[model samples]
Target: MPANPQAYRPETALLDLGDTFWDPVDAADFPATTLRFRNDAAAAEVGLDTLSDAEWTRHFGRFAPLPGTLPQPLALRYHGHQFRQYNPDIGDGRGFTFAPLRDGAGRLMDLGTKGSGQTPYSRFGDGRLTLKGGVREILATEMLEALHVPTSRTLSLIETGEDLVRGDEPSPTRSAVLVRLSHGHIRIGTFQRLAYHQDEAGMRALVGYVLRQLYGEDGDDPVRLLDLVVERTATLAARYMAAGFVHGVLNSDNINVTGESFDYGPWRFAPTWDPAFTAAYFDHAGLYAFGRQPEAIHWDVMQLAASLRLVAESDPLIETLQTFAPRYQAGIREAMFWRLGIRRFDDRRDHAVVQAVERVPRATDTPIDRFFFDWFGGHVPADYPDAFDELRRLLDPYTPRKDRDHPYWHGEPCSMLIDEVEAIWAPIAADDDWSRLHAKVAAIREMGAALA
Candidate 1:
């Protein structure tokens, strides 16, 4: 009922950077608005949970500006490498930053849209998103967050009265729009855009803006910025590996400057510990496969360094880039421990546990999440293979974070593999039933609390 929630803090930080970053745009006037999904939990973080369904639909579904947020949407501009190929023309073709605001913790966040409408970067295609695509993103973000992977949160999904034809899915699929909450939307390609044009001043200004707003730093040192980005990026890759997730696209545009994962497309969890597992059908080369995700992200980080080269010396950038490998390795070790619910010991012992964790799954073709679920807190299940003996011994000295008594750990571990995703979507597409989807989300949240 309140016009402005007491906890919400609207911000115009992105606008302060000026027009060099984005172009103001209007949201699409949809034929009909049908609210499909609402993330009340995420809304609560931003003090918008008290809104009635009508108010929520008005603000998100119809693109009505939040009370004190951006008066109009801004279609962001940036360029990225698409599967190792440089693409200078691509930007937010179908999405725009709708609101810039801070959460309850005062952390700067952006409410961005997908399938909103065409922009300068729309090119020849219609700016629309498939309903199934929006659903997939919701599942991806939920599972990743439950697994403790840093990622964007799906805020809302609304069905627009239109059918879309796509090459990937069955034609005449339902269309919808998605809103996501992210720490920041500045991608590495954002810098690449400035570098491609040889715009040193824009690069400097962007760097300063990123530091001040996202990281809370005040300096414009690109090298130092690159270092921080590399650390977060490597850790993100490590966490993805730990969670058995393959982000089908690791292009420069998809890699956020803040290192938080966003823009979920064709993402999947590996059913088994197979290195060659890939999520996207179009990825013939497996460049972004499950095991090679670390490499792909590292390559992206290199490209980020190359973009910073326009303003800073290359030697220090290269040196900072070198730290990515060790940080990634250490990150993997830490992530493995976290998943296993074990307190980390020294590197030698921790490395042994990680090696055993990695080896046992591949050797036995074990389900990734199930393996962690069964062996959580180092309690080796009766069915655990003898190959896990080494890991069990390594886990002995470390303290366990949780016992197997939690109800969530009692049955089959919740997984979001491709087949399960299709099962969850089948009813929604055929009969418009969303019960399974809702139930799955509740189960995942329970898993997250158990893990926490």
Candidate 2:
């Protein structure tokens, strides 16, 4: 049964909060706009699946707040240490929270934009996203969600007819506006922005608000918050490893308060389990590389701990921060087992199994997804390949979570390789042939459903 949209209260509550953490803003009216994508599946959760294309555009693209939601848009204010260098001048430069809504469980969710327009933090840059950029983000979010990573869902993509020049890609490319549906958009940087101003009241207000809106509580204990953040960050990093994903950027500003992943820029799933493989072209130091993701995310969690000092003592926060490493290790083990589709087994033998599987990939430099596709859930065949002999033997002591007869077990995996992504994008970029892109999205969703 469809949930009553009015049972959702955050949309009204946020509007009543009256721009405490954000500034009122208006969307840039664009030219020759056309809706390019709509996530009906995600919208249905909020009872918005019935919205017509024009209605979706009028609300999402034009920033017209939905009925029973916020009355206006808000460009959230924030500051962050970009690459460990303190940067006070950062916030929602190109995007804003258009409105807040609730899912079936009545959990608060924000429908925010990525290329809406310039805010106070725009500095001297153009506040527009390229059409290709939006498409890449959609692919990234979809693939991550399929891998069971708590990630954002790209709700809509609208091409706003504009020719933009950028050094990162080919100049005079297409432009777009993107809307993402997620648990919340608040970040460690959000609090850091307030701490920079030494606004104690603001910090306390934010802590309380985040606890209530996102965490389902109103407790103001910053230490408890830090603990939750550490655990969530650890689990998030573990999931990234299991999925062979490198987020590319692990800045505090990019880390969502709810621990879900969003802002998919310069992200990639590893072709091979190479620790040093990086996604961003300019990430010369590999600061946010594949294996170093746990380190990067741990650092972000600590920064969040630092911000909590405004309302709590540093000792408890620091003590909670120390849990990140051990939590991350445990998280890795759990996620690794889940990926293999095994819930219970001999722990010692499971360790051996994990080592065996990892050794095969490391030694052969094989694609990580291939291993899962072939041997997931401890499915071992008599004719198994020689490379996985150790893995197969290790599986002898294990049991799968389900019967190994699921249709997904017997085929070439639906891989989201970068090459394949480009193959899908080539037609769209060259001849505006969206058929391939549409097909890829459908295939990816099917693969996700099968895995689920």
Candidate 3:
């Protein structure tokens, strides 16, 4: 019943392409109110977000007036390797891609919502998401942005006047749907679904669609597409390691085929260097651990490759996958150096920084949060001999004391390291002092120029 339809395209480009289940229009059945609204600069780039509220509800939302904007209601279909085992019945269980929209910066982004109630894929479950889930996602996205990691931004959160049940927590809990602006919603499982169905044409069509939508400038070579995906994914993995982030659920269904970070469930920043740190309660085996992220990324990429084989199996695709390890390592190293605040890595200084921080015996299992917070305030200990001496002093109380030999204190310092680094980088992280840092770096460059 909306007059304009073109305005919704920016929001419709990212919808799942499989099945559509229409929501019946009755104000009582689907009473909605906007709780929060966010501007997704990433999504805006894709020529989306032009739709009016009525148009948005009509095309993306179920309860609408005339013929729906989208030709049909669609849910994405995909399979995934959950915790290293194949799970075929997983797709968008509680969420769906609405459409893509261009933001202020003109970047095309997916405007998708989580907890927007059920579809055929709901699988006899109450298709609702908790407010806590929405809160966690917002925090994770904000933190990732501050830490310079590429992630989806929370655009809006709408509390639907409904109660739903979930297996993890109490039932009859309040529910809210979250709209996130992301690069693309195409997941690795999407390809797998087509492969499992032996739909080569569909696979090819999907691949072509992704290439045009995300990497149109790269031309139409499927091998090139494979190479780019591997490179981007490898870089993303390295960034994750550098930031001490562990994506608890790295199932194929969760891995965005566009190589963007998607599905923020049970994700956490490391407190220590434990290769086995996991955020998901169900991940008893720690398949998506801190140290194993790179390998896990490779495994996911391989799954994508396998799916691609349904269309074309070639040496080039295999070769592209093989390049993942080296690229991943390089990306990790670069990201680590950046986080450590060492403009250039001098083996001596880098080791000294690492050792000095590691040696400051932690006194408690106190989180690394305070140390960084104090350091960002330019506070260091007088006892320590470094630029961050004041910060070290501030961190001393939290440092593990020799008398405190609890398990909590043992590996806590490693966790503190990231916080400490973030503290040192906070000025830059805040970006308010970038001009000054830039000027200082420039002055140093000038000194080198005079020396030369």
Candidate 4:
């Protein structure tokens, strides 16, 4: 990692341009701020590694504006389709892009907050996050990152001195604000908002910014952008399938322009290989279920293509959108290989290796997480029930990573199963004992490092 160590190379790229994509909003000061979690890895990415706990709390927890960053956070504006219904009353109601800074790799990143406070978009609800929700997000990102999925990592979690009332959780739960570190906060909904109002100039400006900031190598052709987004979104869906994870909300607003998965809410990992596994309780039709993720993402990229029609013709966009199926199939095969720590030996063997994992899960009662853990690193234990015999032949051509010797590889896989997550949080909720939470986070990170 290379970087300038002193000050943040902050930019006012989006905010400086005024209210085209976002509205300047001030962060609300919490009554009392206590830092609950800090991501040192993310800190080093930007130039905030050496900041003391007091300083971190002052800036992130207290909502104090960064010295070299934006004067105020930007509450982004966007319209999205919620469960296939057009919803215009949606935007960054509770969160904002607090800062824009660069990393060691010189890629622009956003420090965004959730539960910071209410904005103009906040209709009638309080812009507060339950401590439970914050904890869940940390777990979601930690586990997903370890599995090599493109995702947002939690940077800071601070408990505010307030009790938030949530319908999904126990009443008057502890309130908290969360900051996440990610590549970009620009969403598919951003383009939709522009298109909704027929803001052709705004769409062009946003598209230009994305091309310059993210896909610099790709020329600023709208069709090329559509192609890039389709490929990425396809890969993203494949990763979710390979990881056995379900992002409960597949709304346009939840989909980011960078193709990095963020805004983890009601997320869950499948206990077993079930196609109908739905993460959100409100998903009555199973629209965003595990099996339908690829389809949902296909729909989303189409929406982006529709938005891009302001700059390009429909024929190229339609042609590019059709590539998602083949791309997704290829991506799933690739992701499976990465998860198992193997490289391609031959086309037959590679196909057999991927098929073994998919076919074995449906043929047996083995838990999905356990299936990957037991057979990962090219070691197919004998007890793996109903596993295809061809998998053994596939393993012969593959060499496992030496890092498999880690103790985590031998036991019941360190998993973020729903029961396990609840158990980890039970102590913190009742006794104010955060020992379990800390231990769990450490274990998750260790699992991530070893897996990577």
Candidate 5:
């Protein structure tokens, strides 16, 4: 007999950390709850796919508590540097951690909401999510996951019957509530808040809780933890570079302690290999531009190290921070080679390949996605530019893994360019036509499978 979906376990691990890290809040009373999109595949992993539409809406849309999980939604507290400026005023303003569950593999994961309601951190703005924004998030997560980025999975998106006015995009837009599943909601900012308040005990407690709940480890060694976080962040940065994804907001608070990418806003994929390609228009200085993502991520990791000083020695934490550069370089080398389907020969050849990857795309003005698609599995084109001679030579020894057999590779490469994004959203905005959205997601998944 098939196992019952409700048999999956729920966890209250975050609650044991105490109320200092969060505030209890009630979900907003929305005018209507219409399920816009449901990730049944993700639900199946967590044994929630068996729920009826009304049950799913009640749990995710209406924020009903799961048994033995979150008795109430929690607006988590933390401080972050927004655009490099220290800001103690930020937290989960319009969202909260709803509950935690164990997947089929018995790994702990969290279900958090965006634009669910207002909390103490809501600031002066009304707590609501524009439906367009939610749709964009769906697109971002789907594409990023297809590209193998360790990211939060979009579990559900429910359209709430309300009109929201926003500065960006068209005004009087529809609203929504988005649920995402990630390792856990705890962020680097969670540690920053404790460090800011000089709460050493709180820092220790937080570290212990994170090691147990998030990492599934017993020790709370901040130095060891920082090292692991640095490694993961390095890998994340490298993956973003290989995928040509610009996160737009690398704010310290936006980074999770688990090193997974979340909080999609003003994100964009590079059309070309231009280093200055930026996502958010407000990034006047290009602080979080495509090329500077590694720097931005490293800077956030440094702040995390600073936070760990409350419980660990500075020398050891600093030592861990130094590893970010080398680890990031290695990560980039591995990611690029994997995406290109080339086998690493030696240090020199790998270094040359990485340099060629950086140089060829920029010099050729090739769309980053097209470049990867064309050169996949070392299948260098016969008419390749003279500048690519060294790269082609380096790839000569490797056999092509992807012989362009995948249907997706036989045609145009799948990409998430800005204009394409606008085109996809236009029909949805005009007539609520989600057909294009569904089709695009299917295509992206096909591309992912091909790349894999």
Candidate 6:
């Protein structure tokens, strides 16, 4: 890697940009002649700093700065199973780790680049990323974070000075590299790789490394490590279901061992509970639909536990796997209750909530996105009159006529709180006044505090 210029160099921090395998000459495969750098807010929370103009071009490509600072680079290496098969040939192909940053809470975060350039893991294809793909990732991270899911944050996107050819869509459209910040990048497949090679020492080393990096050395019991991963996986899976998110690809490579959600590709949030809804075009079999995520996560956990056989026994591992289903269900119930603003968790109420959600038309199905708007905008329809008169008017248009007679109407008063929330968030989504948006968010935070 090249050294940073004096003005761009950090005085106390180590300047460790560029991977050991990075090759600037491989820029030939990219249609874009230059790459640009941008800051990611999510990455910033973890303490990432953007690179200076000269440093960005020298390391990332000849791309210019896009009105943001560039952070130091940090390359990450991990093994993962692709499509259930162990593959040792995977790690930051077109992307490399940018630096780690500390957030307001002092949590260490890693900033990484996607589509920055090519590395040894590029395989046979160009390591460039598409602008559309970058945009989708930004949307995924932003939306998922707002929904309170354990997800990687999309920090920034910089359009390259060139175009790239792809098999899908146009031959040469615009290209970009996205920066994402997350807890850790280690994956379940990372252990699987060592297990497949019968490298017990490597597996042990990797596990120890993970314990030190993510859980601290004091919490390094093999069983405990396995259990933590299982528990976190269950919690994350439940959160995904609550948020209506489908990862589209749950391959081992995409399963972060640290339990943080990573690698957002072909992901989607469902508008309804269709078990077969898929986000990836290539997921023809629906193996990774929204409904299958929990099961897929269980399978991935089993694989991770199996890889730990070198350090522990199979019986205890299988026992850990058995705990996944119940744990996932419990977590899902809790998350759903929070999302719906339910104060109590009763089986009957849970059933009612599910039924009510099923009956409510999706945002895309009608003008429901604006339902709360109309309600809070001070117009109340008479047909669905109730204590939540405003909310009833908002939801009446989306409710089917047949289910209008349900007893769920008893809980109608809750709609006032929901309406208030919508009123607070609507302007933010519309890109209304920034000061007003901040005030609204503050108000929402206060509401959350009051609820607590």
Note the Cα lDDT for every prediction shown: 0.90, 0.82, 0.59, 0.84, 0.89, 0.59
Q: Which one wins on TM-score?
A: 1
Q: Per-residue lDDT tens digits of candidate 6, residues 10-33?
A: 121112222322222233234443
Write candidate 2's Cα lDDT for 1-452 as tens digits.
11445543447555544466788889999996789999998888787887778888888778777776767788988888788777888899999887788888978899999989888889997889999899999999888888888899999999999999999888899999999999989898988888788888888777777778888886877777777777887899999999999989889999988889999888888988899999988888999889898988888877788887877898888889889888887777788888888775766776676677667887888778887776677777566558877777777777777555656556568778788778887888899888877877887787677667
- Candidate 6 achieves a global lDDT of 0.59
**TM-score: model 4 vs. ground truth:** 0.96
Using all chains and alpha carbons, the TM-scores for the candidates as numbered come to 0.98, 0.95, 0.70, 0.96, 0.97, 0.70
Give a tens-digit lDDT track for model 1, residues 94-205: 9999888889778899999999989999998788999999999999999999998999999999999888989888989999999999999999999999999999999999
RMSD of 1: 1.1
Which candidate would rank higher by TM-score, 2 or 5? 5
Lowest lDDT 10-mer window, candidate 2? 1-10
lDDT of 3 at 211: 83
The CA lDDT at 337 in model 4 is 83
> What are the candidates' C-alpha RMSDs?
1.1, 2.1, 11.3, 2.1, 1.7, 9.7
Steric overlap count per candidate: 0, 0, 39, 0, 0, 20
Candidate 2 vs candidate 3: which has greater TM-score? 2
* Candidate 4 local lDDT, 63-103, one digit each (tens): 67776678878898999988988898999999999778887
lDDT of 6 at 266: 72
What's the CA error at residue 280 for candidate 1, in Å?
Answer: 0.9
lDDT of 5 by residue, 1-452 (tens): 11454556888888888999999999999999999899887778777877888989999999888777888999999998899999999999999998898887767899999999889999997889998889899999999988888999899999999999988778899999999999888888889999999999999999998888778789889988898899999999999999999999999999998889999999999898889989999999999999999999999999999999999999999988999999999999988988887677788878888998998879989789888888998888887678888888878777765567788877888999888888988998999999888999889889889878
Which of 1 and 3 is the better model by TM-score?
1
Q: Report the Cα lDDT for residue 223, model 2.
A: 77
Tens-place lDDT digits, model 3, residues 109-136? 6656677666656787666677557655
Order the numbered candidates by TM-score, best leading.
1, 5, 4, 2, 3, 6
